[model samples]
Target: MTPSRARRLLPPLALGSVAAAALTGCGPDPGEPWAGAYVNVTAYPYFDFGAAAAGQSHTVLGFVVADPEEPCTPSWGGYYGLEEAETTLRMGEQIAALREAGGDVVVSFGGAARDEPATACADPEALLGAYRQVLDRYEVPVADFDVELNDLQDPAANQRRAEAVARLQEERPAGTPLEVWLTLPVSPAGLSEDGEDVVAQMLAAGVDLAGVNVMTMNYGESRPDGQSMVEASAEAARAAHGQVRELWAAAGQELSEEQAWRRIGLTPMIGVNDVPGEVVDPEAAAALNAFAREQGVGRISYWSLNRDRPCTAEHGDPSEANDFCSGLEQEAGEFTRVLGQGFGD
Candidate 1:
C-alpha cells in the first residue's frame, strides 16, 4: 500500500490498554517452527485482535517498530508513541498470547508510510544499538525490513542498515540466530535495480538474510490488461527467483534454481489493490497458495488481516482504500482460510 493511502486508512489513536493473560519468559529460540499467514497488527478492530487467535495465521508480523523513539525516532501510525501504542493496542500482550498459542511474531522495522531507523539514523553504531534494543525487547526470532519508494532510492541508508544488522548478528549469543527478511516492491518484470542492490549490499556486509519477500500487488502501469493478479504474481515470483540467483552468484554465494526459489517469498495485497482492477479474490488466493506450496517458498503473506472481511452497507466507498474490510464479497476470515492453506508447511 502507498504511504498516503495508509495514512488515510488508519484510525485516530486513543490511549489505553486491554488487560489480558500474558505469557511468561521471552527469548528467541532458533528451533521454533514458523509458517502460515503473516498478519499485520496495527490493522486491528476489523480483525478483532483477541479473536484472531482462532484464525489460520501462525505468525503475526507487527507493523513497524522495535523502538519507536530510537535513532531518528519512529511512531506507530504517525501518532502514538511506541509505549502508548503497546499499552493502548495491547500489541505486546497479543504477541505473548500468540506465542502462548504456539505462534510467534516477526517485528517489522519499516513500512510504506513511516521512517525506519535505517534511513533516519546516520551513525552505524547507533543504528545497530537501535536494532539491538528492539531485539532485546521482543526477543523475536526474525525481523523484517520493508523498503519502498524513497527509502529504496537511498544507497547509503541501505548500506548502513546492512552493516548494522551484520553487527547485530555477529554479536548474537552463541545458540540464538536472528533471521532477517528483506521485503521489497515488485512488478511483472521482477525486482528493480534498487531492490537487487539492497540484497547485494546485505550479502557484501555478511548479513545472514533469510530471503526476499516480494510485494506482488499494485502493478500500476506494468501489468497488462486482462491478466489475472494470480498470473502477474506468479510471473513476478519467477522473475525475482532468477534475479536473486544471479545476484547471489555475483556475491560469491552461487545457488541453484531450487535454492533461489526456496529463499523467495510472495506477499500479494489481499482483495482490491491500491490500484484499481487488481483484485485478489478467493480463487486467485487459492492459485497463489497452490503455487507457493509447489515452489516450497519461504513465506506467504498479504498486505493485512484487517481487510480480510467483506465491506458492509454501513461502510463507505469500497474503492476508498479503507483498512477495515476487503471491499469485496468475503466472509470474515474467509480470505485467510482460502489463501493460507498449506502455508508454513
Candidate 2:
C-alpha cells in the first residue's frame, strides 16, 4: 500500500461554516464541503455569478480542460483560455463579483465533453503547472475534478492527475492548503471498479481528498425498473457512502458512518437527464435535498445552473436534454431554490 499522505493540522470546514464565513467577508476555512450547482463556464448565454440563485451563494464553474491546440494549456470548455475567457466571457470579473457579493466558486476541471489535462499533458511537471495555473488564477479554495468517459479509464492519465493534485496540495501553505474533490460517474450499485481505482490512486498518491461526488444521474440500464430518478440517485449515494468508507479503511483510515457521509457529495442532472425517461423534477430535487440534510451529506449540486430553467421554443424539444435550459415546465432557478434549501443552515 502507498504511504498515507500527511494529514493537515486544520480540520476541514463544514458546508454551513464555509458559507457563513464567506458571507461575513472572511476567507473560507481551507477544507470542507459546500452546496451549489455547476455552471458551464463557456456555455451560450453567459450566466452571472454575482446573482445568488435561490439565496445559494456558492457554485462550481466547470470544464476547464486541456486546449486541443496547446495540449497542456487550460481553456474554458476548450474554447476560451484564461485571458480570453476574462475578455470574451468576463469570466474573472464574474467570479470577482460573486466573491464580492459574499459568495464563492469552486473551479471544476474536466467534464464529459473534453480531455482532462492529464490526458494530453504527459509530463508530470507540465500537468502540475497546468493545474496550478487555473487554481492560482481563480484563487479558489476548492477544486473539483469531474473525471468521466475514456479519461477515467486511462491509468497513465489518472496517475498523473493524482500526482499533480497531490503535489499541488502539499506545496500550499498549511493555512491555505488546496482542497480537492473527485467527481466520478456512478450507478445505483455504487462506483464502478475504475471509479474505485481513481479514488484509491488519489489516496495512495497522498491527495487529501475532500470527498467523492458521484454524478447520480443517467444510470441508463443500471436504473432498476419502476424506480424514479430521485430513488435511483438516493440509492447511488447511499451505496457510494459505504464504498468510500471501505476505501478509506483499506488506506489505513477508518471513518465513521457520519464521517463517510460527510465525505460524499451527490450531483444529479436536473430536469431531463441524458438518459431517456429519466427526469429530476423540482419535487424530486426537494426530496433529494431533504435527504442530504438529514444524512449530513457533504455537498449538494446539480449538473448545471445553466439548465435550471424551463426550455424555450428555441431549444427544440423539451423532452431531450438541452444545454441552455432544463427540459420541463419550471420557473427559472426553481430547482436551485428547492435543492439549495437549508444547504448552509
Candidate whose lDDT is highest: 2
Model 2 poorest ten-residue lDDT run: 1-10
- lDDT for position 242 in model 2: 95
lDDT of 2 at 278: 87
Please report, in order, the local distance difference test score of every candidate based on alpha carbons.
0.70, 0.79
**CA displacement after TM-score superposition, residue 337 of candidate 1 (Å):** 1.9
lDDT of 2 by residue, 1-345 (tens): 000011100122333432333222111222445678887766565656556442456778887899989999988888889999988878877887877766777888888778989988898998899999999988988899988998899999999999999999988988887778899999999999999999999999988888999998878999989998878888999899999989987777777766777788889888887678888899899988877877767788887787888887877788877677788889988888788777652
Cα lDDT of model 1 by residue, 153-176, tens digit: 899999999998898888889988
Model 2: CA > 4 A from native: 1-32, 52-55
Model 1: worst 10 consecutive residues (lDDT sum): 10-19
lDDT of 2: 0.79
Clashes of each: 1, 1
TM-score computed on alpha carbons, candidate 1: 0.86
